[model samples]
Target: MLVYVVDHNGQPLMPTTRGAFVRIALKEGRAKVTRTKPFTIQLLYETTSFTQPLSGGTDPGRTNIGEAVLDAGGEVLYNAHITTRNEEIPDLMAERKAHRQASRRGERKVRQRRAIKNGTITFPLEKERTPRGCEKPIVNKYIRNSEARFVNRKRPANWLTPTTNQLVETHLNAVKDICRLLPVSDWILEINRFAFMRMEDGSILGADFQNGRLKGYPSVNAYIFALQGGCCACCGKPLIEHYHHIVPRHLGGSDGPENIAGLCNECHGKVHTGKLSLDKLGKAKKYAALSVLNQAIPFIYDGLVELFGQEHVHICFGWQTSEQRKRLGLGKTHDADAVCIASLGNGSQPRQIPEPYEIKQFRRHNRAIINNQRERTYKLGKETVAKNRKPRFEQRGHSLESFLKSLSPVWRLDACQVMEVSKSTRYYNSEGRCMPGTVFYRCRRKTPGFIHGDIRRQGPSYGIMPFVCLHIILMQASRRGVMPT
Candidate 1:
């Protein structure tokens, strides 16, 4: 394990695993421990500072983000995989809302005595029409009594869902921390954009070329044409190049890059006239999830440039990083991909990948009870706390000696004597009623589930995967270190 160090001013220094150097510094009182979790320390005495050019690579995902920093020599320095709580946030929020609603329902009682003092005789009444088409007075028992919502709301411009915002924030914060800890001169973000279905068909239109939902492309067309080596796609001829839709427009085919291709007029005519088939043209299916994440590219780019300066940050497609990892024969992982991105400018030198420490964003358990958490019931019908229960005991009042005293001078005291309970002395509540030595009987009381120690386990029919259904199988597989073979 390497111990992270910082200068007197808290600026980061290269990590060191040299035990003697650290021990000497601590023994000489030159350094003081700063953080125990990561075992980091800061130098108390001034020290000369030296840092090398480093690049930061970030592999952002929906659930986990991988970060890695590499020096100019292509050495892995820092590696971490931060698991985010994107999905949990919403669930927590829902729980909080329920708690708040319970609070509004007047569940929490203060000091017990306060409840007695403030108990209301009746709820406020509201007049309303009844289902029988008659106006009648009714209690307004449904009052939220908390806060009134506006009842109408609108989403603000550039709005992002809570989960997405959290994800973006996680990525930004992870990147920011790395920048602060390392002398990051360049930032390489591996953002892979897939054409998905369009690319698989090989007929997709170029950005600068004529297109429909696929916008016009300037240099993107050059890349597409380069793929064909300036030769017509349909006819091997190098003359009279024209873009044509493989599938007819009336058939719901789009002008997407995968649906259009470079072809000679003769081939284009033949394709439109149904003399040629797109399937015969080698079209294949490609699956890619292209959505909000792709749009986040510009947003993330702007953020990086603002933090690291536009000149220091560079963008590389995810495929490029994947290719680098394949060439280096590195294991497939988020951290390995990050290393690939950082090594994009490192040339062809063989570099070792760093081991990543996983950081789980687990929900810390709160000792406080969740509000309005009702007990689960086997069979239910308005189960409530039964009040006015009479205590049952086999013996009369406390002890026989106390009962003897209550008698004679009170052989048979007035049956009108009511039990007077006082605060427990060395015991719980004790009343001077039940007139000593009177026989008692046993009465059974059923405690609510909330106070019970245990209950019978549910049968196998209940299953063990209630929560598991919420997880996407593919995502769970990825998290389990499994490759989709």
Candidate 2:
């Protein structure tokens, strides 16, 4: 294992593989541990800034990032496969949106009740006026009818979706963090620009730009209907309207013309319910991964240039990386691709093939204070009757009574996920023996409660064990150097 080192002034120097030297320095109070998981130390005494020229190579990806630092002589210094949080962002954003909407509705309800009490409005649904030419009457004058502010909104030239932006940020932050650890003078990034149109049809000429896949067709459904000869694929029923997917959207299916099959309503329902099958419908075209990669590549390259300077940062295409990796007899992986990217200009093979660092990026801070554990008692066509329940006791063998009995006088139930607080990080060696430096407490909670880092000694006294707090050393250890405060 390589130990990254820094000077007395906290500036990063060359990393050392000498474990005994590092141990001696620590024992003699010459250096102190700065970070773990790519273990780093800062020296107490001043040191010279002389260092070897190191170049970094990164395989930019939507979900996983490959990072590697190499010396001038093709020596792999620092290598890591960083798992990004891009996939989780969308779901979290959707949940946040739902929460915000619910909060706004609750606030509006409270305001309406207050207005009714103060005689500002008679009742919650009391109508004040109706706009001309509008069929629906305007109810509740107290309810604010805000103007369309979205019309005046302006986006910058380089604007990306939240997920893509987060992904790009992850790449940038990963590079920045690595730079802080090692002296990276230049960077080589592996990127790909997909020609989606060419991939679909190689025969497509320049004139085909004017005429798209759905040029004459009004909609995709209409196009599919025409493609299927206006009849159901399973049953030859005329006047087919419903569009059936050969492969479901959830199962990596695209809504392209090839993936779509025209079917009657009954046939569509039958296909969905597995009562019937359409063998004529070929296959589903999946371009989601490719599309995401294509969209993110430019942004990632631009960010790299801005960080490492235009002269220092060099771009290598995906094909070059693949060719080199194949010639080097390396297996296809993110880390291997990164190594290939680094060894591009140099003819010699990488000498130092150390075990690469495996680093997974964590979600910075969870904004969710409460786990909305709602169980639906009854579900009709459009209505669902749900009862709010404690998140922890929902599982078998966990109960509120047991939790209450275990709780101390100082302890109170706060809204948070029980799993997070109870989670303990225990590192193990290659022989599967548990090592030291476990961060969170292994406090197994009987019932769900909030995760407050402030509960230091409260867990042990009550036999619950110390729970992992979010704002404590956990955040610093995990999410450091990613986002600025």
Candidate 3:
């Protein structure tokens, strides 16, 4: 691994691979560690600011982003793959909205009770009327206690969805980090702009481009019925009464024809009950990635041009990237594609291929504090009881014998107990050896005290690990490209 360096004034200099030099500099108090993940250092004395021209490349994707930096000699200086949390955002948002709605409903119930006691409710209650067979009940306006504000809520011209915003931010943050770590002069970004109609069918031309799959059809249900040969996709029956969503609506799936399929009532019920799978019926075409990329790419390009000048920022298409990658005989990975993007039109083949840093992004902190956290319950003396249930067992495991000497402490206690533990993952070096770091452990101590005993094969280790701690430490680096030391 190479150690990135910066001057005494905190300006990024070329990174060095010599371990001995860095070690001696640190030993003599001439340098200090700045970042732990990438192992960067900063000089404590004055140094020359002269540097060679370098170029960088970025390959943006829906969930993952690849970045690389190359020196003037075509030597690969740094490369990393970032796995974003785009896939989990929709579910998280749904959970948050659910919690908020529940809290509001509880507050409204309290208000209703108070109003009844105060004789403030003079109006008669009325039942809401909803459409026949609709699952959602139409709520009365008075009982709703809130006016419809969706019409008043206006979105800005540059507004983006939570999913797309997270993706765009991930790409921008990765680029900003690399630019601050190296002296990159120019950047090449590979972004794919897909033709949705052409991708679905290659024969679309002229007037057909304007006419979509549902052009002649009266409705989406009719189109799907015709597409599936007017038969149930699951049982191949002629009775097609229901339109099933191949991808469920809860997970941000759209109502597009590609995601909807014709199904009978029996098959639809079976699908909802998990007896049938979507793949068994027919493979559903997903355009989620395409849609996100189309909206996020323009914002990403504009952001890059604003940060690094318009002249330095360049855009490359997927076809050109594919041609170059094929010519270079590189594998089809985000990192390999990034290398090809960097060396595009420059004929700069990498001297040696190195394992790129695998970085996974996580939310800094959870926002919902009162959400439905799983309650730990265990059989205590033939009766199930919650761990947090209270008149309270606060004694240590060692001292538990004084309370009941006939049975062992483990036998007297339940199998599961609530305890605060750090979330951790194993980190490995390029040599395929695991690096020393904190691991996950369950504490048996009912009260706050030193934990002793085996932690599920992790061995007897003691420490007060915090809940949801940040294991990966980030370094504070300059956000601007190259600055004078």
Candidate 4:
């Protein structure tokens, strides 16, 4: 039999006529017999070779070794009897399968355990039974411990009678004293008494102590009690000393505690008179005030001035007011409350107006109003910007092709240059049939239809074996301004 080996370029790779029955050993350790019978050799030559052999024979009479295979005139024979060995193939596959199965089993066990822990599976407990010689379970039996007696059954009626209550209270107070003396006593006598009393009455006392009760105000009593517990109304701090009105009473606002908050002195002062505006209060307080104002500006403005001092207040009667209205050359006949001016002390020089009392009063009343307007405008602008921002390209499902198209011309040109280099190498080696200079060796242990294989080359530059011909072609075309579709 005669055999021939070829490289990726379809060129005759070995020395012609050097040997017969040529054996090609692939890098994956698989060897194939290309020539076997005399008849097969005749068929190969007649169908694939461009020349004819001098005589009919199974042997090519030469050793053929090279980088590519060529159409040599010869009586070539092929066979299917070649065998390759790879001992680790089956073991590796078996190990992979075992690992996969174990992982699946572990996942299933974890899911089952989670289900059971989450009460998705409920198992009935087995009924308890004593041995034949043991006594039956007893009802209404009492077990005595060091501190108390535990009853096996429900307690009797009349557990909270006046006489019993008095006796229990007396004993409980004494026990409390004793616990205080011992310090390390296991019994919590007061807790036990409270629990016993609650259980006996089937209800709790003092739980709704402030229910429906007014504390000199028309607001919800619960908030007043909360205020009394030291929570600040303006900042929700826990150490409040001053009570702030959401709407000042001077503007016909109610004295209801709901509209008032218990605030610390700092928060109270910042509430209306400081740079902080009513609008800058936390969301909870802001929403609460909005509910009271019913979106009315007159009420909101009045509330702002009352909480913030008039001197710093900037708005009144729907306009800004300041002490320097005359210095700006405004008419004296204008209504003092209707005129608009900048707030006095926000780095603005204080003007010496004729009436000091009126100036001081205006400063005290307008501070909060101006700050509130500024804060509201700032918030609106921020929200508008957030709503109008554009979506990012990555978030828009851009494909690789689209992304490449969007790159700058210079980057595209560079990519084309790279592609051209690859394409040149691919076609240069293959004689228009298969890419040359590279060898693909299939694993003997692999399944017949599997394409998994190692890439190799016969030349010294084995470093670049089995090049991706398609990538090279496309890259070349791209460089030439003819990119692949």
Candidate 5:
């Protein structure tokens, strides 16, 4: 019974008797050992002595000696003086260890090769540097371009050949010559036509040539040339001109020469000012004629105010100015309206509610107050005017009460299963501790009137109580066939 200590690979690191004692000591923490073999164990004792067989026969002295030594309290010395030969043990352990080492080396080599192939393992291009007080080398990696490039060292793929380049240049020069044949205004008109050209035959050149023909007409040429010179067509006034279309595009008029006309700036202004009856031209041509005039005017401010209302026109102008500032890389600061609270009643009491009889009387008073406040604000500083104003809750007038009462008749409906708002609960855990829970709600209504209208705010706010109000109005109106007279 020879004892041996081996590593994961079954390599013997120590011989029998001494190895057993060392193993026990290692287990007891009195000694320590490391092995690449799979086995780790402790032995109770080690000695060399003879033992009799159960059949009453004496065993071989050498074979029984190992067991006898283990049975005794005396420690067996695995010294050079006492040697036992076991040729296979060393050979077997050596073979196993070699096989395992080869396997590990092969695995490591495969990983390294893979890394190199994938470019993960790359040689550093930058020089190594050490910190001011440190001796360690600091490795740095090289940065490369992210864009894809061809492997060829010659010109880029999209670069034109010398022959193609010459051909393009020749064609471009020809086009320029043809463009020069036309006046500047005609050139602009041709370009506009080219920009908006639509294909009839689903062919590119056909559409472009067709549009060019239309733009090159004598009538169009005369109109555009006169327009470019800023001469009014109605009176031949050189002050300014407006391009008025005979048939308005919005009313289904084409961009044909026969559909276009010109007007004096004054006449155009009068038309939009409602002094002239545009209805005389028919609704179809009215908008188209207006559009043409708008385009011809040089002053954008006046033209925009004429088209959209003053409020919307101002907003558009503000947006345009903002965009221009951004393009020029300039910052803008605008003063915003400030919010202030004013108390109308005494600090102790709620605001008074006007009686039914006093409603008409208070109406006059309220209008007067509002008018005075406006006038005062115009005369005084903003801060002073705000300080002077008071916030008063007005009584609900008969009209307002009637409006509320009308709403009471409308029914409120819960979301149907098909369009219900779904909710989910979630629990979180971190670092072996349970965290707080949370609930998430998702609304799934897609159609209009799923919610009420009057109280409903459009857009994102439509999903709340306002939605319910809107839905009620829609349902009630549909049921009663009540036109909103």
Candidate 6:
């Protein structure tokens, strides 16, 4: 553990070992405790006006990030791992997409039903182009009568998915905050590479290699047939064969022989189209490790340069750091990788390895519910806010009672089924859209009367279906909606 320090002016300074140094300062009224979470102190009296050239290193990751800040003397000042919250981003995005699609469809239906101007939607369905004398389906009545949008497949040149953009922002934010507090004039980030070229024929790949192996063809695709010992990589067939990229090209697999495999014509097409399995081709994922770290190059690199200035930012490869770690006999961990990375920035400085300070990024644990909500429309939007603010317990006693009491007594009807049809046709439009109908209910709960409109299936008409049957259904969809007269 270390004690964080600040100058008399409340400006951040280098941290000191939590021993006689900090104890003496506190005992002599030289410093006062400012924060207790990380045990930081603020100097009450004037202190040193100088700061050391601190170097920082980061092991950027998808789920968690490892960070370390070291002083010019190679002494560790701060180190900690951070857990990121991108897991729910995808689920939230899917929900948003569903909401947008529903809204668009509702708007489109309303416009068509009212014969209003066709706007808002990007691709309005158009009528079929007919010959001069040929007839086309009637618009609105028989079809949407809108035109199919032809040009809707373009995006801004420089664009990243919403999730990807957020991730990049999170990483950059962490680096910026560290630089502000520490006298960090230098930074190092360890990035991985997809170096299929370095692999040789019959050599196994790391588990992070998505498609496992390329059979026995090596990594070069230029002479795949020649490298396979004049035989098919699969089935040991001496007959003519076709080459295939173990992983599809669009999915990051390159044309190198290491990513190439030999198969018969039939097998080749199947593999390309995903009809044949790689296991059937005798390729195996007998490598150690579940995933390979993806190095975000130009994306993270350019941003770091822009933020820290190019002279301050330094980038290193995985192999270089691994070699360094091996020479130092360090364990394989994010912190160890970061140490090697910081060592590069430390240069020839020969000082004791600074004790790592495990710092984790945490603004708030988990997430606030508001992070998952968006602007809903009308009543739904209001209800959502209320639920988040103060959740109301739904009393089931009068929920369906309100809706049931609004139903008319079907004693006058001859058949129960006719009562069902009348209830529907009278209260709903031909398209089965609910229409307002009169509803008056007096329940013991006096739950404020509401004229709710909903499409009801016919068989459960009031005075037709048994009370118990109706009770069961209302329990399932107990929405306190009554029809407006």
What does candidate 3's lDDT look like per residue over 237-327, in tens digits? Answer: 9989889878766755568787788889998999889898885433343677888889899999988898889998887888888997888
Instruction: Give Cα distance to truth, residue 130, candidate 4, Å.
Output: 33
User: Which is the leading candidate under lDDT?
Assistant: 3
Per-residue alpha-carbon lDDT of model 5 for 1-485, expressed as tens digits? 33344433332233344655665677786533442221233223343322211100000111010000111121221101111122123333455556666655545565666766677754664546554444466653332212222333478654543323332333223223222211111000000111223323345564465565446447664755454465654456765455666455544555554455456778788766877544434223223323322232223233334433354321213333344335434333220000000000001111221111100000111222222221111112222212112232552222223323433343212111122212222222223221122111223366565232322212344343323233445456567553221
Give the per-residue lDDT digits (tens) of candidate 4, residues 1-485.
13344333232332234343332233223333333322111112212323321111010000110000111232112111111112223333455556666655545555656756676532332233443343563221121112112333456753443322332333333323222211110110001012323443555567533433464455454566464676765566677676566665444344555466666878777777765555432122222222222223233233334533344233322223324444455443222211112222122332222221111000112222222211011012223211101233444433334444666987866643443111111112223232322333322334443232222233343232333465554444446554222
Q: How many angstroms is residue 323 displaced in model 6 relative to the true structure, after the best TM-score fit?
A: 1.7
lDDT of each: 0.60, 0.71, 0.72, 0.32, 0.32, 0.58
- Candidate closer to the true structure by TM-score (higher is better), 5 or 6: 6
Using Cα atoms with residue i matched to residue i, what is each candidate's TM-score against the true structure? 0.50, 0.64, 0.68, 0.15, 0.18, 0.50
lDDT (C-alpha) at residue 281 in model 5: 40
- Cα lDDT for residue 1, model 4? 19
Listed per model in order, the count of residue pairs whose N, CA or C atoms clash below 3 Å is 13, 0, 0, 53, 23, 24
Cα lDDT of candidate 2 equals 0.71
RMSD of each: 22.6, 13.0, 13.2, 44.2, 45.1, 17.9
Off by over 4 Å in 6: 8-11, 18-37, 42-48, 110-157, 195-295, 348-485
Give the clashing pairs for model 2: none
At residue 281, candidate 6 shows an lDDT of 33
User: Whose TM-score is greatest here?
Assistant: 3
Model 3: worst 10 consecutive residues (lDDT sum): 473-482
Instruction: Please give the lDDT score at residue 476 for candidate 5.
Output: 61
lDDT value, residue 140 of candidate 2: 53
Candidate ranking under lDDT, highest first, comes to 3, 2, 1, 6, 4, 5
